[model samples]
Target: MKAPGNVIGFPRRSFGRASAGRSEPADATDEMSDRLLAVAEHGDRAAFAVLFRHFGPRVRAYLLRAGGDAGRVDDLLQETFAAVWRKAGQYDSRRATAAAWIFAIARNRSIDAFRRERRPEFDRQDPAFQPDPQPDGEETLATRERAESVRAALAALSEEQREVLRLSFYDGESYAAIAIRLGIPVGTVKSRARLAFRRLRAVLGGRREELR
Candidate 1:
């Protein structure tokens, strides 16, 4: 009962076309935000506190919609403000209102969290931080072969399987967030992630040891 869309519809048989009529809280929020930014930019902690008090719940709601946890919302909220403090100068009215910018930051942080989780972990050579080196020529061949096998297995999976895996592993999103985003049941997300991981195990067998 939904229309096909190269522009919008999902590329699979499952998820229905999302409604196109949802409105943003942008305009109603911008006025308060601009003033707050101006005050906070001048190092007004009281004003900054006011802004945070007012906007904190809004930001939490926004982040939740973007796939975040209730438990971690406070942590993310703190990070969002810290970012606002550091990047106040980056706010450009020509693009977005202050609230919109803040909201966008929250959304981007959510996505960035996803992107970061997709990367291989760093090693601790200096007891601080260091990037892991990539495989060399001969080792690269074996690595590439392994990558190919993973890709092939992933390619052969149902779209549902691949998507759940991507959201969990690649996006670092939780089951609830994935369910809300995909507009499916929470149980469905959990089940699919489980099924996908199982299939991945079947595909990789002993070679999946590196992931653990």
Candidate 2:
């Protein structure tokens, strides 16, 4: 049997307890977003525990989709939540729910890690040090929410469709690139992407109408 702190090889349950001063959240019925904001506003450890318990696996999966290796995924997951702990104060619920906010942090951190890993050497003249332009707050929020909607829609896709979409869109790979990486034919890659996009557009359109 696994140990108490063990969570699918992440070993975070004990860390959550130590940081939050409570056991990990066992309740499945809890609303996590409001609880996460409560942690942000009041430094509530129990709320933190709930947030970690709920979002940890999803964040880990997000990191993997962004091309994070198995070796670094755990470290990246820890760093992602640590930033959440520190920057939760900056979270704006009017713009993003707790889940979207968490994902944005994870995505940005994963990109940073990917850039660092891909650089063979550091040079002062390296353009990597130059800051990329940031989207304005409203634009950033919209992008994050759109990403959240896409992620939700992805869960509804067939696994094959989901895998192709993740590689092409999230990892920014071309059809040929994904074919080589996945050891599949280029035509099949294009087919998968076309179908995935069609599904995503339908799903997102329905979601927009529901919001009205």
lDDT against the true structure, per candidate, is 0.62, 0.70
Query: Over the stretch 107-211, how does candidate 1's per-residue lDDT look in tens digits?
Result: 666666644555343434458765334434443333224444667889988998899887776555889988999999999999998888888778765434643
Residues 1-212 of candidate 2 have per-residue lDDT tens digits of 42433322322343453455224344222245556666677666666776787899989987887787887999999999999988888775645667767877887787778875552434334677753344355434343355467568889899999999878766767799999998999999999899988888786654344344
lDDT for model 2, please. 0.70
Off by over 4 Å in 1: 1-30, 115-212
Instruction: Name every residue pair that clashes in candidate 2.
Output: none
Q: Which candidate is the best by TM-score?
A: 2
Off by over 4 Å in 2: 1-30, 57-74, 89-97, 116-159, 168-174, 185-191, 205-212
Clash tally, candidates in order: 0, 0
What's the CA error at residue 32 for candidate 2, in Å? 1.4
RMSD values for the candidates in order, in angstroms, are: 17.3, 10.7
